[model samples]
Target: MRGWGPRAAGRRRRLRFDGWIAGLGTASGTRLVVGHWPRSPFGPFSDVMAEHPDGQRVLLAPTRETADFIRRTYSFDAVRVVPVAVRHAGRTWTVTAGPLDLRFTTGRRGPLGLLLRAVPGPLASRPLWSALTDRPARLLMPGVRTRGTAGRGRREWYGARDLHPVVGVTATWQGADLGGLAPVSPPVRFGFGSAPRAPSLTRITTTVEVGAGEEDRAG
Candidate 1:
């Protein structure tokens, strides 16, 4: 794998999405966490687990709605949102997204440089490779830091054992303000475009579902 292909990657090994809730955390730089998974049927702990490479994880919810969604989606016992004001440089940066501090930072440059440098080749390299191989050769190799692949370490906190699928709920939340430093928008509503692509949490039943077969399989 060379880089982020315009098409979504296979396996959904890591639940990465298109856009993220963008805001500055108490940390030094602006942090942007993905707001939705480009693929469907994303699970709790999947999104945050994907970001372990960057050394950051979501710790709180940004709004009441977001909090409720997390609980309903993953059947978490409870959740708490902490608000803090962080000072950077000589100036104080107000928390914009309130308790739900979205994660964002200056990461790596995307595939622009590599894509532009892709060379046109075909007949010349034919002796050694066929058209099938040549096309891939023209493409850039995937970044070393891409979400999931061989050699990448697993996140310390969450995993498949922790995954619990819900019909219309998710663990993601919109971080609104940062310790009164900055103000962020509310969580994406059920039908609103702001919501994740997973599903609409309009009437999520809080009752937990326990499948005896699943429990037996685990045992």
Candidate 2:
């Protein structure tokens, strides 16, 4: 594989997405994580990843472009392009994607959130910073990672700015109530990392860097 160097770096392009990621489990034995991005190279869009009790993984994206990008970066048993809408009022979030309807509320930031907030945005979002913090993040929050390979010769970095406990959630899939909120057990298996075990909403900036000569086709 080609390694990062001045020549390779010059051929790569970076795409950043400013968004909120919410991960939670329902009493019905389904774990769902939602990414609502209001700023991105492709404009605002939302995506949903749901894991059924049977361990089936599905990705619900708002468009083919978004679906292709997400599928390239993560693993999923199935991928679907559907209408995805995400709205929020205060600390509460509402989402509608395919057969899913989710509503959740977040509480005030906690200690970790405060600590993350202290880091300057420019420094925190740097890929180098994310790589340096990956191991520590895994130790501090099991299954969470700040940096990782994203397949297709792309590397990804997650810069978390803030986090808030998900206080409550009411969700339904295919018109079947998913019951109340619970811990995100078993950890989601979408990518190289999972969200914090404790259900929460996190404000983050995700950066994806495409390999040399691949910029034109990357999202």
Candidate 3:
């Protein structure tokens, strides 16, 4: 979701967040929705009503600036933002924007950098970096633009559905299966494409990591 506050006198920063909603309709199965939330707080409502070719509706929560933009641009009855139902790990693992379950380290050079430096030669990690950074090459996005954001973390999961055809499968854990895991976020940044240009504050994400012994206890 985008921040709702006084807009910048000049050009305001552009932030895009992506998330999956409960199946928009039975026919469509699941609807993929994106919001110009940073651009409009009222944007979510517009998306919810907007029809997809596949017969799906989008839900969005536009920032305050977005509300004004809608009035200025479309001239419609903008409604208050509706919080979408976020399904994290179901009852086992709750999903929402708060903190991530994993640890993170940031610097001008982070894991990407360390991996690069550890490798030998001038173009040592370039290929690896490109592979990991560019989603399309890895089949996530088309380009690479590495800027600094406030906080960045990734939730590593093993054995999940195959979402993209090009990449085959998102990076996964070795020798682990029979479970589902998702990266938790406070202000979850949808992976792929580019990182946020704005700086974010650090936060702790609390999660329930089920133990092997505990799994035997029936709910």
Q: Each candidate's root-mean-square deviation in Å?
A: 16.9, 4.2, 18.1
For lDDT, candidate 1 versus 3, the one ahead is 1
- Each model's TM-score, in the order given? 0.23, 0.92, 0.23
**In what order do the candidates fall by lDDT, top score first?**
2, 1, 3
Off by over 4 Å in 3: 1-26, 34-51, 54-59, 66-132, 135-219
Compose the digit string of candidate 1's lDDT tens values, residues 1-219.
122112222422221122222222221221223232222122221122111213333434444444443433332223454432222222111222333323222222234323322423222222222223323423432111111111112111101001111121112135323221111123222111122222111101011112222211100
Best by lDDT: 2
TM-score of 3: 0.23
| Top candidate (TM-score) | 2
Among all windows of 10 consecutive residues in model 2, the one with the lowest summed lDDT is: 1-10
Off by over 4 Å in 2: 1-8, 215-219
Q: For candidate 2, write residues 177-196 as lDDT tens digits.
A: 99998888888898888888
Ranking by TM-score: 2, 3, 1
